[model samples]
Target chain A: MRAGTLAPGKRIRPLLLVLAARDMGCNLEQRAVLDLACAVEMVHAASLILDDMPSMDNAQMRRGRPTVHREFGEDVAILAAIALLSRAFEVIAIAPGLAALQKSEAIAELSSAVGLQGLVQGQFQDLHEGAQNRSPDAIALTNELKTSVLFRATLQMAAIAADASPLMRQKLSYFAQELGQAFQLLDDLIDGCKHTGKDVHQDKGKSTLVQMLGVEGAERRLRDHLRSADAHLADACHRGVATRHYMHALFNQQLAMFS
Target chain B: MRAGTLAPGKRIRPLLLVLAARDMGCNLEQRAVLDLACAVEMVHAASLILDDMPSMDNAQMRRGRPTVHREFGEDVAILAAIALLSRAFEVIAIAPGLAALQKSEAIAELSSAVGLQGLVQGQFQDLHEGAQNRSPDAIALTNELKTSVLFRATLQMAAIAADASPLMRQKLSYFAQELGQAFQLLDDLIDGCKHTGKDVHQDKGKSTLVQMLGVEGAERRLRDHLRSADAHLADACHRGVATRHYMHALFNQQLAMFS
Candidate 1:
């Protein structure tokens, strides 16, 4: 579990959670925020381990290292993934300073994001439909399930922690939806380029937005999503300069590789 | 998930939870008790799916049918297991009439039972050390991890639901521990018998109490455990006549097969 989670990688989901919590004016202790953040990251890490299994994506490398199953054997890897997932809920269930209702709500959100309506469904779709000729709507729905559900869960958990107004939570939900699409599109673009130090051509045979739109068209769609995401973020957190700046820098660093 | 969980089975863990809750005078709605019971059964079903995988026990049959992976492929089987586990937590989190603190405590107990200190650790030990020359104490610890931890969690969750006194909770804990040990030993004994209608000889090469003590000696130990468990149950629930009757019938049914 440590090897899969603590290895050097961009903890984008947890960072998004922390930033959103701060943007929502969450006044909880830093420890509470950090624990929630870690919980989100643990879920992400667990997904990656399962995804890289021989029966799933069959990827041999992750984070520039042997995948968990490759390093630890499949049984241990599966157990580690489960351990991480269970520990994630355990962390939130016992997190200090949060109200019982808040913790319960957070656990509900996180578990749903990992269950039938989220990662499991997303992965099932990817495995069963990636090579098939799929409609744009189908592909987008898959992307939403694979990426945005967790993003929505992350921000919604932040909203719960902060006791944000319903309207603010709605805006953040929109923001997460748009940002998650843009991020996945950006990843698709990166997968096609050889100079990005990533595992290139991962989507070589898959039906993706980039496959339908080409690199330039995909880039245009990505920009549209980013613009929409920024608008929602602005509406949700007018004074969230740090969040805006960090998102801007991160996207620019990846998008610039295309230029 | 449905195929794995809703299949015909004994559902001993969930039954234990329901019985314990009733014995503790839990006055929550029947739906709440049913939901909690289903959650425990879901967790048990999820563990069985993983344990039957090709990378683990390599078992081809479960509950008298082709194992999940054999029927649905390993990837789908894995996702189904995870979905079951996640849904278990979700059920508890959203269970009606449960106070937020009660929900949180139940989630903590259930998660720990599935995580490092519970199922994962127990499965790991079984996979890594099952065939080794382990000491009696080490073997007992493994049995406790694989069996008793969830039993303890089930009863503790019931205690929390009923708001039982700490003294009553302690007695239930002791009751669950002894019951769980006896339950595991009985399973081992049945595994060695050819006429039990079970998938016999599962522990043919594993280091088990039955292996160390022989069938008669193991039966003696099981009797001791059952006696101790009854004593604890008597202490825990003086008026739990229904629970005691059910346990007595279940055990007699299994043990009679040997006679």
Candidate 2:
């Protein structure tokens, strides 16, 4: 996939995760934390690769450059995507100092986010018959599968690594859900604006938030999701001064984007 | 991919691991064993998907059926392959009553095997500029990267799940190495024969065994590799009656094919 396409998106999820890990006392210098960061980024990268493939979005350009399929050919693009995903797992698995079992759980979590219950299924839902014209609920469903799960998994893995309590993890999961929705909404807007000549509003035919609620309603729901995301950061805020700072900065950045 | 193409290709590695697990006293039920078997098969399926992509072998047929890319478009094929891989992880990750972490570890192992150090790197080597008409050792380097690591990881996961001793796990790894070589050799023979008129000996040119030794020498090497596979299994053999029976049958079946 074109690095340029990925470059267009703010790497908000990974940055938050790295910050969260730091707040939870994970050593940035540790290979595991570093590996985790790379793993999350690879997931982000893989998503773009798939998104740009001829079937999914049929996108010609991304990040102001030709998509992977366009540049490398479909065969190389697909293998390259697979290669990135596999390497993400390898990097984490081979990291030093983490117990073998911890490494395993991390791998499992990542896989779950990408697999049937997650990205693939989400993509399938969009691709399935009658899905092209999405209802609001259907669009929400796609957003959850295609985007939110990875955001959720990212925090879950970092929190698990930091040995956070179950409650903390739950809070983080909620935050991820909201954050993911916000990100998806942003994607819809960008796709709508930039892909005017293409099938930008094809989601209107599928089960998408845009189809169900109209453009204005979808934007409103996005705000609500962002609010929840900010609210869920309360626990993190209470935990430590550094964490509060991170939460504030993250929220501020998101707020600016929405504005 | 056609379901028929994925029909039980000996399932040697997974069966060996489950048997090893039993021998090590893990005592999993038939259902659990079956699940692991499926997981292993999924890995095999995923490998086929990658192998058939335009960049790699660009093989149109697999196991006498159309490849995934042929059946579905390249994009769907890629997603389906990923779906299979993710499902395999799900099977292992959520195997009933197993520790979550253990499941995670198995997933990590499989992913690593498929990723950079394993299949991906192997594919990379095959696709590299230096790959064409390389020396035997260079070809071996690609084969080991592409095929052998996965072979080793399969046994290792089985051993880990079975709680086998570290020493025994080492033995299984050795067995897997030889088995992998034998398996690849068989692949070479099949491809060399079947694809002779289709294109250049595409996969064969990617082999070290063939380049260094020539086709006849490579044939001898394959036979030697199988012999070594038998020998390694023999070294690991012990009191497990079922395992012994299965291993004997497996070796005979594969050995017969080559003969």
Candidate 3:
């Protein structure tokens, strides 16, 4: 019954959301913004619980502890995940200090990211695809749905909350997708290079960008995404000194993890 | 995945929601009402899919067909359920021709109905309770949370959509809870009498009212609830001839089913 047992992994999604708000000159600690961050992390945690179920990845360990299903049984794991998803919307709806329309906008943003065309479809593809038979394009699409859509959602929600311009929101959307892919690629590379006490090596046979591109090619791809992320980060908001510094610090830290 | 594979069983929740709106002089065919109905049913169907999984009910049959998990395996069934939940929210958010705040209200209602204090906690209690260990009070609480709460939500959402007065909404809320319990009681009575091709008989040891209070006592309780339901129906909106006629017809039909 305990959710969020995995601690918060990197909190990249929430951090990106806050930084995106900063880019648009919104206060970082606005109660509504903080609520959105909590809601987003709850969703991420819920997804992780489901993903670790015996029916999904069947991982024995996550973050050096037993997976949720392994610890609480599959039934509780699934129900807890469902509860978290529902609670995320509840969090957004009841968040204080936000206009009514803002609550609706954020709710819409989060719900769409988890529906048929987003995480569910992506997880479906991941489950149905033959480990050795998926094409690069299929793999890319799955990445977008399963791992990246929520990433895109957090940034989009922040932009909406800040009332950024439509063009700026679009730029941030692009930035999110690219950043998501780069994050997954680096994760794969880390797993391929060393054990992570989880299912990382078990998925070695599965098609991934890391396998598709090889180390050098994947590095090149990551660089391209990083550049795109930087450019859009600038365009999505003010590109103030703090925003630039924060983006560089986070991205550079992730990059350094490879060494 | 195929979400509506079970052919949308009975449509009772949506029917109750729409009928509630009709009681308040709302046009039954309004797009917003229709979308709300669809969203309610989707949530019900999603709950059923999970309930039928090997990890939960381990059900072999549902609605006279192989259970979703049995037919498509646990992986697809889980993902499909998740998709349906998300889709329900999406339907509420994007339901055409509704005021923005109305959409937000419905979204909040539905989410809260499914979260830790609503369906999820109810379900957790159901799964965790030993067949013979639950008390009548505990059973009643579980029934309220797991079944009545969602029924309550449907009526509440309908009221919100129709812009009904607070007193009217409260009356409808009471009506919905009584109807939900009555429905579940009748269902249990039917299960006791004959096989429904589902897991009804399999739960003989479970703490249903029929088991806790004998068949005769349970029948009395059901009738009492029907009376309460009629009273709430009168108080909730107005007792127009059509509304009274509709309520009488529905109750008689349900009562006749028991006979």
Highest DockQ among the candidates is held by which one? 1
- Residue B233 in candidate 3 has what lDDT? 79
lDDT for A119 (candidate 2): 87
Question: lDDT of each structure?
Answer: 0.88, 0.69, 0.79
Model 3, stretches more than 4 Å misplaced? A5-8, A130-132, A195-197, A239-244, B1-8, B130-132, B195-197, B239-258
Model 1, span B1-259: residue lDDT tens: 9879987899888787788788777654667777888889999999999998889988877777788899999999999999999999999999986889989999999999999999999999999999999997898888888998999888888788778889988998898888888988998888877754335787878999989998899889989999998888888886566567778899999999886
Worst window of 10 by summed lDDT in candidate 3 chain B: B1-10
- The TM-scores of all predictions, comma-separated, are 0.97, 0.83, 0.95
User: Model 2: per-residue lDDT, tens digit, A54-168?
Assistant: 7777787765667777887765676678778777776776677567666767777888999878888777776764445545666777788988899888988788678777898
Off by over 4 Å in 1: A195-198, B195-198
Candidate 3: Cα lDDT at B79: 85
Candidate 3, pairs of clashing residues: none
DockQ each: 0.93, 0.46, 0.78
Which 10 consecutive positions of candidate 1 chain A have the poorest summed lDDT? A193-202
Give one digit per residue, the lDDT tens place, for model 1 in A1-259. Answer: 9989998888888888888888878754667778889999999999999998999988877887888999999999999999999999999999986889999999999999999999999999999899999987898888898999999899888888878889998998899899989988998888877654335787878999999998899999999999999999889986566567778989999888876
The best-first sequence of candidates by lDDT reads 1, 3, 2
Error of 1 at B241 (Å): 2.1
Clashing pairs in 1: none
